[model samples]
Target: MRLSLNQWTTRRWSVAEAVDGCVRHGLEAIGLWRQNVAEQGLAESVKLVRDAGLRVSSLCRGGFLTTSGKAFAEALDDNRRAIDEAAELEAACLVMVVGGLPGVQPGEPLTAGASRDLAGARERVAEALAELAPYAGERGVKLALEPLHPIYCPDRAVLSTLGQALDLALAHPEEQVGVVVDTFHVWWDPRVFDDIARAGRRIASYQVCDYLHPLPEDVLLGRGMMGDGVIDFKPITRAVLDAGYTGDVEVEIFNADIWAADPDEVVATMKARYEDVVLSRP
Candidate 1:
């Protein structure tokens, strides 16, 4: 298994620290985030990764096309900049977390009585994809649409299933638009195996993390380390490899606990967990 550590897995580490950690642990790949890359300076980030000989498995984000009017245009502009960053890093794909319900005001509760049209938000995402996919392709970057778990439907992302992501990706060329098979999001999908198989060559990236037990108040930070939660990785891992996805698998945990721990230990734990739970099936 080609294991890549997502920078978010050790959320506190800087991009330079993450690169050094990967090198220290003998990992050949690291997934990057745009914020840290920017803080480190794009040219420096490129050089750092090149010097460390670390391949960027995937770039953190590049979507959020659910707004309207000026916000919509701004969102598109941001995505273009994201594509440019991914190109500089030579990332495998830019993970796209298309925004959620349109009208929820900042700091406002997503559950407020207003009925949000999820379908409409998804339509907006499709429209944005049509506009951005060609641009990404021209830049030699692929947009990997990532579906968040349905629990985040109203607030974070409208794309809530691998099948739904695949549905949207069908309109574009496979090399330009693809679906991400993130275990934390797609593990509960009844058709995960089928959809992964269907995704086939269109599977741009495969992210692994556990869905924590006893949901935390901040569900967004509830991603657990593998084996510390209920996700059964064997089937999912096998299905992904069977589907012909020959890309680095990223461990993208968001747990506050893991982030607070020493990053080197986190990387070590990730390696052990991958060997134990993720790879040792049967």
Candidate 2:
């Protein structure tokens, strides 16, 4: 399988700087974020990746199920724009972080003892995905649903597990919709192995990162380099390969500590760890 790195690992850097780091580490692919692309103009960013001989594996994110009416419409429009940007960059897929609770933004005040309407949020996600799928399909870009951990259920994403994400994708059954397997999100799941097998070829992309403690903001803190973490990545990697996934293994660490260091050093360290631990495993 080819190896890729996500710009999020070094979100502290500029888009150009991130691309340069990926190339410097000999990574074959890289995932770009919407914010990063916007900062450097799509044409220029695309050109930079091409010039460095790197493939755009996927775009970082798009999807918010919280708002309604004008808010929902605006979200859809932004996703379409993201799709267009992904097409311009020739990315393999547009990763979707399906949103959480309705009418509640992250860090917003919550009603006392108010339970989140998870089912409603999921239905909204499905509807939004259905609407966006055809558009993404028309652009020849796949939509990858990245199931955030349950820790993010209220604020970040409602799709909390691989099984749930696969269920959503199966419901759609369209070529445009698929699932992304991120180790950090799914490692603690009891059914992760089973879902990985189930995902099989429907796996749109794979992300590698480690978590030592509880969910924190996107940073590398508790995340030990691949093997340094508690996860059994070898079996997971083998399962993915056996299930017919030959896509790039994209390393995505959201650690503040790592970001504070030089971007190039972080890339190099991740590449070396991936090669020594995950890749070298039998």
lDDT values, one for every candidate = 0.91, 0.83
Best by TM-score, which number?
1
RMSD of each: 1.6, 2.2
In angstroms, give how far residue 62 of model 1 lies from its true place: 0.9
lDDT of 2 by residue, 172-282 (tens): 654788999988888889999999999988899998988765545543255655765678777778888888888888888867777788778788888787877676355
lDDT of 2 at 18: 78
Residue 75, candidate 1: Cα error in Å is 0.5
* Residues 1-282, model 1: lDDT tens digits: 699999999989889999999999999999999999989999999999999999999998988788878989999999999999999999999999998788764336755544478778888999999999999999999999999899877777888999999999999999899989999999999999999999999999999999988879888888999998889999999999889988999999988889889989999999999999887354
| Count of residue pairs whose backbone atoms collide, per candidate | 0, 5
CA error at residue 247 for candidate 2, angstroms? 0.9
Stretches of candidate 2 off by over 4 Å are: 107-115, 214-224
